[model samples]
Target chain A: MINEGCRLMVVDDELIVCKRLKQILEKAGYDVTVFNNGEDAVKKLELESYDIIVTDLKMEGVDGMKILETAKRKNPDTRVIMITGFAETETAREAFRKGVFDFISKPVEIDTIKQVIIKAQKEISGSKT
Target chain B: MRLRIWHKMIIGMAIPSFIALLGVLLSYGYIDDVQKRHGYEQIADNINDHVLEVRQNENYFFHFKNGRFLDKLHKAILDLKNSVNKISSYTVEEIGKEDFALLQDAIRTYPPLINDLYDNYLEETNVTEKVRAEGRKLESFVAEKNRTSELTSSFILHLRLLEKNYMLFRNEKSFNALNSKLTEMKKLTPHCFECNPYIEAIHNLFETYKKSDALVAEIQLTGDRLEEITRRMAQRERQRIGSFLTKTKLLLAAALVLLSTLGPLFVYKTATYIVAPIIRLAEITKKISEGNMTLRAPLREHDETYFLATSFNTMLDKLQLTYNSLERSIELLNEKQAQLVDSEKRASIGLLVAGVAHELNNPLYNISLTVDAMKDELNELTEEKISEYIEDISSQSKRAHDIIDNLLDFARARKSTEMEKQNIVRIVKESFNLVANQMRINNIKLEQDLPDEPLFIKGNHSKLEQILVSILTNAIQAMKGNGTLRVSLRPDPESNRIVLKISDNGQGIPEEEIRNIFEPFFTTKPVGQGTGLGLSVCRSLVREHNGEIEVESKLGEGTTVTLKFPQYKENA
Candidate 1:
């Protein structure tokens, strides 16, 4: 498929969240970069662009909204997915208005994330043609 | 006697009136008796007057020497007897008993003696006439004898003159002179036989004169006795009248004395009986005014004041009833206020748990996905990879367990009021976790300046947590987008107290409004947004923790809440 090996970035304040997402998404055949904190994820976003960005909504310094804004500003085609420990939060409502591609609450199903990424991959490939 | 005021007054007036009535009756009796005595005196005086009339007529009889004078004297005596009987009718009953009887006895003897004198006078007159007639016959016989007859006739005229003198005087001296003259005449005319007849006439005349003199003496004695009896009757009447007046005076003075002394005494007794209950009620009213509400007026009198006391006591009862009801309402209001505080606590817990549960979902989702991946790779996965998956499952489980345990600790301690030495740092973190999601969602930053060293305080863990939660909730509410909530905890070395401070960079309270911020029902938040009991409830909870809370703010700048508690020295 045209979406195989598409570059993706994951950001969260929890280390286990980053580690598990990287391992599972790599085996599914997509390029994955994990960040334990939103600050590093946000800095990395400025330096290198990604096809997709998955980030935690709440972080110590740079929250998910900041990252979402930066990722969209640099590349409008870049799909930013927001992940949060809290489901249906006020920030989550605002995140959609900010053009977030997807939202995932904590204790997420890794399969659901994969299927969502696949859907994004098919759309991105179709758009480039 | 259940007397009304008017009844007592009437009795008071009637006492003097009764005395006056007694005095009037006694006076009337005295006057009536005096009139009767006057009549009795008049009766006694009339008896004496009739006796005087009898004496005057008897004198007329003796002076005139007439038959008509004797009839008049007898009529006067009869009139005296009638008057004596009239006076005697009043004797022993009104006055003069013994003296009147004596007078009656004297009057009884008077008429008899008067009759005897009348009879003697008639005989003396007869004897005198006979003597005169006999002498004249002797003179005629002597007419024949010439010179001797002339001498005898002159001597006979002289003897007749002596008889007339003895009859007119009726005294002892005149009668003795008549006898001597008779003897001298007898001596001169002895030789003349015609002179013998003149001697016989003179002898009978002397006997009649002596009997007339004795009868007059008996009549004079009876008249004297009548006069003496009359004088004594008058004296007895005067003495009896004097005693009657004395008795009347004694009774009248006694009545006056009774009125003057006992009349006022009755009035005073009645007044005291009427006024005592009212005075006692006044004292009771005074005590009630002083706030002793238990007092009541006694139902003492059967008068208008008794009704006043009953109504007054009923008024007191109603007042006490209203007061009791008011107190009960206040107690009920206090209970409702306590329930409101409890509800506030529950609302805060609900908010925390809801957010925390929702917040835990992502980690749980991640662990679930990883477990599914591990199951698919279980046969082909290398030992290192298997260890990684196992590590992920266990760590994630541990993290979920830790979060739930923290929630349980908060919930369990919220109602447990047991005081113990608690770590201020751990408590602060636990309190922050409950509201941290709200902070993150609102894009507000948390700045916790906590010492690595555990600051210890002696307090109820839940109450201390409630203080922090409530203050943090306020701080979170104060802040908006991108606001900062700063929390700091430290132990003061000098005061030996643990101090925790929570501040927010948000809209702050005005200085004047802040004074009322801790008062119940004083809300900076719009109605329904806050119960306004939050700060007051917080202050009380902090006091239960043995802590002091201070809030400082500037309008539009920020609000800082500081808590101070005595540091706990671990006894163990």
Candidate 2:
């Protein structure tokens, strides 16, 4: 079971994709915060702690990779997942090596993402216990 | 006309005048010779009569002296002496002589005999009276005889002197007269000897007068006869020459007439033949200068002028051919200009359509994503009452996405990229995937007769795929939602080309409009539902790979579009 109050950040330059992801995650009983750019997401993350961060790989200023590096250094317990429309394998491999938790291809089915979020919550709770 | 007449008249008059002059000259020569000969004959007769008288005088003087009538004899001898002297003086003056012997004999004997007769008359006075009477009678007879002898002697002496003077005068006069006659004859015939014979005869007479008066008279008669014969011959020659001159003049007149009259006629005919044709050729050349190339003149003679006509005709033929070729080229240029204008209009329209489609795509994509999220949210609602709403939203969102995707695909103006070897079959399959649902919606039975083997072509993959999709979509749409569509792909063995054919069993395009279907903005569909650029774009794409597209359609039957792409040969 996942805590409904755990905060998660969703960042994407496209307003529609960002809004959709926030709505879906809110329906699934999690507190979600949405930002239209990587810079805004990074500013919010510096002010408060988020349990998990899901971000678009391509964004204006302060990309997902840079946010991941800064968030991990500021708070080592925070988990980050990279999301992109382009499914380039080399970039996925590089993200994995850089300590990103997971990579997701866009036009992603809602059920698959829900399963991935549940599994990631279990792992976070187990680590805390 | 007057000049010609003048020429003829002058020729005629000159010829007659020349003949008459020649005749007159010949007659004048004959008359002069005859007159000279007659004068010579008269002089000769006079000399002969004088010689006979001198002979009679000598005979009478000798007879009276023999009869012893001394006084009567003296008177007779004096008379005879006077006659001899007259003859001698005539001979000496009329005829040139070294000596007049007849006159000398009469002078020497008669003067001595007359003196002797006078002495005898004084001594014989007392002789017998009877005898004296008889002697007186005899003396009277003797006196008559002696007077005749003296008269004869004086006549002979006068005749000798006259003959000498006459001979000298005749010699000088005849020489001068013969020279004058010879000069006149020379004008006619150059040589005349009628007076020459007379001169020679006179010289012979003078020589003979020294020997005997009778011999002188004989020589003069011979000379006179020769002169008469020469005169007759000269007259005959002059008459013959006059006739010959008249004949020559007539012949010359005839020759003049022939030359003058015939010369102009020959000249006129020659000028007509030569100069007339040349003038006509010059007129034809003027016509040609005025651009009347059809003008031609007849060639009369095979000469340089005729050769010029042939060359001119050949040049005209070349000029006409060149002008005709120029006209044809101008016509071709006009046709090319018309085609260029038509192409430019189509290109402008294509650019406008592409711009409108591009503008609509991005916003339509955002709306589709928002609808998808709403559908998902509806599905997760716990109330079964909203299940229908969820299904409706999902289906509508899918439809909206499909419409936007189709619009985007149509609007995308993709420039052809670099060529690479690509599997043509894979491209075709991808194009089919894009149009499969439309095929289902149309209930069109789609059949693809594509080769299983990987067929490779050198072209841009995206452009080839677009070409396939456009043609297939057209075929399916032509079925009008319920017909059969067949796409056939095959390799042309002879040309090493790949051929693609799409056919539909629905209503066909009109035969008249089939040719225009590949033209941009030419469409049979309702406005806004169809952009006519589909077939046109397909054609352009195929052509980019050096390919060609063609359509065959018949009214109420079917339509088929065939695309042929040349196979890429590495060596080529």
**Could you estimate the TM-score for every candidate?**
0.51, 0.29
Worst 10 residues of 1 chain B by lDDT: B87-96
State which candidate has the highest TM-score.
1
Candidate 1: tens digits of C-alpha lDDT, residues B205-246 = 666566655666666667777766665566666666777788
Model 2 interface RMSD over true interface Cα atoms: 11.4
For residues A30-128, write the lDDT of model 2, one tens digit per residue: 899999988888888788888888887755457777788877877877778777655457768878877888887655665656677777787788899
lDDT (10s digit) by residue, model 2, range B133-240? 432443344345655432233433333344345534545554445445334433532332322333344344434332333433443343344334334433544554
Off-target runs (Cα >4 Å) in candidate 2 are A1-3, B1-372, B379-572
Best by lDDT: 1
Worst 10 residues of 2 chain B by lDDT: B121-130
Cα lDDT for residue B135, model 1?
A: 70
